[model samples]
Target: MSTTIEVEQATGPDLTHRLRDAIQNAEFAPHQRLIEADLSERFGASRASVRTALLNLAGEGLVERLPNRGARVRAITVGEAIEIVEVRLGLESLVARKAAENLTTKDAAVLRELRGRIESAANEGSLVEYSRVNQELDERIREIGAHATATQLLERLRAQSARHQFRLAFVPGRAATSAPEHVAIIDAILARDADAAEEATRRHLAGIIAMLRAMD
Candidate 1:
């Protein structure tokens, strides 16, 4: 009975989460239309549940509802992408500065370990693993910064950023190139150099913005 209940729930909101991840992971490319009937059959959900799930996804910014065409994956424009990077530049630099100011010796050691893991992930060419470690690193820095409001805001921004990363991960040389850039930011934070940490963070994000523009 418990198992049965869990399955029922999984076929509902859990299906929404699964779709959200698929969009974020680029399994569903931008502008790809989502057919309600298709999703219903694919996820073994009812048409009503799938429709509800589509609306939920739209609210999350993973999908957009068209006027008469129904829902499709949200396609990020170049200008919008730049705007996201611009905002991230400010937020990330602030986080880096705070992390530098508040970092403990133990926190520095852990960051160093995480950097090694990032390097390993990059070398192994595992974009998914690299993305996971990168998120862990970002969260750790936010925790070290100890700013509740800023961290909460950054988390919201990160959801949008994840999709950009998923798309960019396919760009040749992106992962390998970003690894050292990330290390520089970590090094500045670990060294307790607030200015350097902020500068490094700004440069890292700026590089991404430049690449995005070039791609466009």
Candidate 2:
């Protein structure tokens, strides 16, 4: 699926959400030019609204505007992907450690449920479910972490490298492997072991690096 999404009706808020969702879902391919007129008609919106949404994504580093080529999904080279994921490793390690300190029993329970759901989806080989779970877990963990700076940076890096994430998830067995890796991170958090949590998170990202390397 092209990660670019055109909604049925593009209200201002609806358009922004649709565009982000489409990008995150890999509805449009990386660097695929998003035709303004086509998108406007596809989402039953005015050309202005589609343009605005694209403009917003462009600001977020998820899309780029070219002089004549129009707006296209931001493409990540292998080096860029590695650099982004490296930054992510540091940010997420902070998240895991802080989340362990801050998460209440109820918060941990919620995370547990989410992980279970992720595992179920992975076992069933549902790529969409896995993708949703992956994002949800990251967001939920950040929420639990309760750190504004970390959350903001993590979201920024995530948006910047979303294309790579999409391709990685689409690989066979990758989604399934990601479930257990998530568990490892969550487990350390629930145990309130900050060093262990950080270490596990590092290992988790390292696993992704390994996966990417295997793909080469």
Per-residue lDDT, model 1, residue 201, is: 93
lDDT of 2 by residue, 92-115 (tens): 999899999997989989888987
lDDT of 1: 0.84
lDDT of 2 at 4: 30
Residue pairs with colliding backbones in model 1 are none
Against the reference, the lDDT scores of all candidates come to 0.84, 0.82
Clashing pairs in 2: 2-27, 2-28, 3-26, 3-27, 3-28, 4-27, 4-28
- For every model shown, the clashing-pair count is 0, 7
Best prediction by lDDT: 1
The 10-residue segment of model 2 with minimum total lDDT is: 1-10
* Candidate 2 Cα outliers beyond 4 Å, as residue runs: 1-14, 41-49
